[model samples]
Target chain A: MTALSALIRRDIRIALRVGGGALIGVLFFLTVTVLMPFAVGPDLALLTRLGPAILWLGALLASLLTLDRLFMADHEDGSLDLIVMSRTPLELACAAKALAHWLAAGLPLIVATPVLGLLLNLDGTATLAVALTLLAGTPALTFTGMIGAALAVTLHRGGLLLAVLVLPLSIPVLIFGVAASQAAITGPLSFGTPFSILCALSLVSFVVGPFAAAASLRHGLD
Target chain B: MSLIDLANPTRFLALTARVLPWLAGATAILLLIGLYQSAMAPDDYQQGATVKIMFIHVPNAWLSMFVWGIMSVASLGTLVWRHPLADVAAKTAAPIGAAFTFLALVTGSLWGRPMWGTYWEWDARLTSVLILFLMYLGLIALWRAVEDPSRAARAAAVLTLVGAINIPIIKFSVDWWNTLHQPASVIRMGGPTLDNAFLIPLLVMAIAFSLLFITLHLAAMRNEILRRRVRSLQMMQANQKAA
Candidate 1:
């Protein structure tokens, strides 16, 4: 437990302090959300209707933006080899790193939802629904994205490959996250259905991602 | 010979060389007969001549899924048994799978343009297929990105298994989502209600496509084996020179 906690703490500190850390992801999320209004034009009604989708897209992209460095920094500094060789199982270590990534990178995107929601002309209730869905969904993105990050870690240039690998896997999360928000905002359908599926996706990825990432990481070891 | 015996690359190569010509010959014959049958089949009362596209479209779609199934099994061979040819099988199938997927998408769009009045729709079937195509590309990209062959194989095997799990989810979710494309007609409880005219030709084309895939896969595996040999030889020469 201490080892896991310590690993998490170390990852979070690096994410907070290095390369603009969580700030970069949040800023990128902000830029993506803010640009949607301008691109879609000044129609407030359109923006409001599109708000949940824009926010989800932003959050997805933001998580992906920060995910590339999940193992890259450790791999660069030779810590990944040590971590792989450690007494703590590599799967647990991977899960801890992903959890730390979610805290530093994913949490802020959800927090910024309300403020960014206003720019998209969303109401308080609607923004809250979007935020709730994002909160449920981003962990799926982070954990799944970890597999891609680990697979790509050995390559000299793997950033773009990581995106290609991760993006399609996240489509279900995007679909359900947006669906739940849409259901809440305007509904003939119930929000619970899609929300439940979103949670299930996160839970499944939580179990699967660490093992897969660990396997890839071990295979990738030089 | 035993499966393990065939795992030897030289044995595999010899076996494929013996089999390739027959496979290629069968594929050509089947394709010719299938196309002739399709062209001769009476036009659909609703779809008219455009129904011909189904012959190509449906088979391509089936092949797209079928190749992934092959890869998934090979991935198991890699992870579980550490079969010598398993990674070669998985790696060689990816590009062929991607090609079939691309054909499916293009032909699906063509069929849809005439039937649904649009080249594309965010329909469940279409979207799921698009995602499958993307996954194939990602697998190929990963294969290219990694420098070490053994490492790439293991990494890709893990990924393939992940994708196998996702395939059913993708299918189910697409079904749950609103879609314009018709639900399963062939594989349902009733079992393929398609007319004999269309069914016979469809089956013929499907067989042809499968055979084509086998022939191509065998050839690709052989090439991969040769490429590895060349790589090792070049590395050996470099080491000798350095010494």
Candidate 2:
């Protein structure tokens, strides 16, 4: 438990400090959402209707922006080898790293949702619903993305490869996250159904991600 | 013969050599017959000549799924049993699978233009298949991205398994979302309700496509094995020179 906590703490500190891409992800999220009103035009009604989707896409891209470094920094500094060789299981270490990534990178995107939602002309309730769905959905993105990050870690210039690999896997999360938010904002359908499924996706990825990432990391290690 | 026996690269090569000609001959015959049958079949009352696209579209769609199934099984072989040819099988199959998937998408779009009045729709089925196509491309890219063959194989195997698990979820989610495409008319509980006119040709084309995949897969695997041999020999010569 101490080892896992320590690992998580170290990762969070590194991500929050200078050169950490966590802030970059947030800034990217802001840029994507901010550009929406201008490119999409000044129609408030259209923007409001499109708000949840825009926010979700921003969050997804933001997470991707930060995810490439999940293992790259450690792999470069040789700490990844130590972590893999440590008494703590590599799977647990991977999960810890992913968890830290979500805290530093994903959490802020969710937090920024309401503010960014306003740019798209979304009202309070709609913004909240979008925020709520993003909160549920982004962990699935982070964890599943960890597999891509690990697989690409040993490659030269693997950031683009990571995106290609991770983006397809993330479609379901995007679908459900947007669906749940849409359900909440405008309703013939119940929000609970998609929301539950969204949560289930996160839970499933939480279990599968660590194992798959660890396997790829171990395989990639020389 | 046991799988272990076939694991010998030379034996596998010899077996594929014997099998390839027969497979190609059968594929050619089946494709010719299937095309003849499809061409002769009377036009559908509703869709008219455009319905003929089904012959090509359905088989490619089926092959898209079929090839993924092959990759998943080979992935299991790579990860679980560490079968010598498994990664080769998985890697070699990806581009062929991607080609089929591309064919499916393009043909589906062509069929859609005459039927659904649009070349593309955000319909769940179309979206999911597009995702599947992207996944195939990603796998192929990953195979090239990694430097080490063994490492690439293992990484790609893990990815294939991950994709296998995602496939069911993708199918289910797409089903749950609004389906713009027609529901299963061919594979449903009532079996195929498709007319014998369409059914027979469809089956033949499907068989042809499957045979094509097998023949291509075997040839590609043989090439991969030879590529590895050349790589090792080159490395050996370089090492000797260095010494």
Per lDDT, the best of the predicted structures is: 1
lDDT of 2 at B118: 38
Candidate 2 residue A194 Cα shift, in angstroms, is 40
* DockQ score of each predicted structure, in the order shown: 0.03, 0.03
- What is candidate 2's TM-score against the reference? 0.55
Clashing pairs in 2: none
| Candidate 2: Cα lDDT at A43 | 50
Clash totals in order: 0, 0
Compared with the true structure, what per-residue lDDT tens digits does model 1 show for residues B55-168? Answer: 898889999999999999999999999999999999999999999998987777677666544354444565567678868877876787566788899999999999999999
Model 1 docking tier (incorrect/acceptable/medium/high): incorrect
Candidate 2 segments exceeding 4 Å error: A1-222, B179-191
Cα misplacement distance, residue B166 of candidate 1 (Å): 1.6
Q: Going through the candidates in order, what fraction of the true interface contacts does each contain? A: 0.00, 0.00
